[model samples]
Target: MNKPIKAVSFAAAAVLAVTICTFLIIRQTHEDVLSKEAVIKKVEASYEGKVTKSTQSKDKKTYEMTLENPKGTYFLKADATSADILSMNRVKAMNPSVMTEKEAEHLALKRVPGTVKKRTHKNRVATYIIQKEDGKTYEVKVDMQTKTVLSADQISNKDQQKTPITKKEAKTIAERETGGTADDADLEESEGTLIFEVDVDLPDDKEATVKINAYTGKVANIVYED
Candidate 1:
């Protein structure tokens, strides 16, 4: 009976030793990992701003840094393990004399008039979510400084119309109309009209926007930019 008891005690001691070694190894690996300050330097190199805030995730595997500069504020996420940049977004600083929400809404309505569902102002950008008569949603972003429409995108649910023209066909039409290569294309709705907004790259570093009707497969509008 004493021999059996001694054998059980030896096994327990071995298990404890293994657990201690594992913990030590993990601790050493963590200590050897890159520090947060090192990661912040990498972000600053790209953004060139004052560090406003820094935080680590609950898992301690990633870091988020907020930096501010004269141009704008930026949020950057980096992987702690490898200090790799995961994501970045810039919010242009608001100018006190910039257009108001109402003004921005009016401007956006001029471009694509519809029922305003939501309006948001942040970091000098005003966004209007508009619902057209056909129940499609459009998201329009306006730049405060220029008081011009920055981008307009449709965020409505997938169209249930199975007979609509395919995206490839839309791009071909856009390319033919603009005499340029279609660099980007997206299907969107404007004023109850389903259209494809395609960005084309033309000669001499020029750009063109081509809007093709999704249902009719016709060129709705084409505008060139220098």
Candidate 2:
């Protein structure tokens, strides 16, 4: 009886240790995710030019901003303890196109190919919220002028002359190196240094994370969304 009790106690202690370590690792990973999201939101605001609408995460460490004028949207991450530049100057320019709300929705749908959750339009440019099969949402931008999609997928900053990295290459790199799936990874971009980012799917249906790396295909970090 003594021996059985000791074995059970040891097992419980081992389980508790694993649980504590997992909790700490997850907390640290979550912070990394928030930090990267902040950088992305800052860069996006700089390019799109405004924070017309904003949403704050429950923890108050993340923000999602919708831009005015040309109408782009971005998600921002901020630290409760650390202050970061969450603002950018607006660019004065003509709206991409003068579009009716309905027209804008149609255009946005064409690009993202999903049910419209919400939409906003100014002049001819319109932005729409589309949900992926995973239930994750992505903002889509449509150009009424060219009937073109201006969402994150299309706005990659790679050289106009250089062929963009295909989805396969991205997957192969992630698999061989990071041991992460590449299905959702798209060729985002790298400046000075080659960089790419892939959104990682977590266990939850609607939650996901992002992974970024250098051009040599070295992964920098993995970022999670709550």
Spell out the clash pairs found in candidate 2: 97-123, 97-124, 98-123, 98-124, 99-123, 99-124, 194-215
lDDT string, candidate 2, 1-226, tens digits: 6999999999999999999999998788566554444544564555655555655667556554545545434344334334354554434445455455677677676666655554667666676656544434456877777566777343123332122345556566656553445557655443323345665444454333444443234456665556
Candidate maximizing TM-score:
1
- lDDT, model 1, position 168: 81
lDDT (CA) for every model shown? 0.79, 0.54
Off by over 4 Å in 2: 35-41, 56-64, 70-226
Please give the distance, in angstroms, between residue 173's alpha carbon in candidate 1 and its true position after superposition. Answer: 58
- Candidate 1's TM-score reads 0.37
lDDT of 1 by residue, 50-73 (tens): 777989887677898888876788
TM-score of 2: 0.27
The total of clashing pairs for model 1 equals 0
TM-scores, all candidates, are 0.37, 0.27
- Evaluated at residue 5, the lDDT of candidate 1 is 98
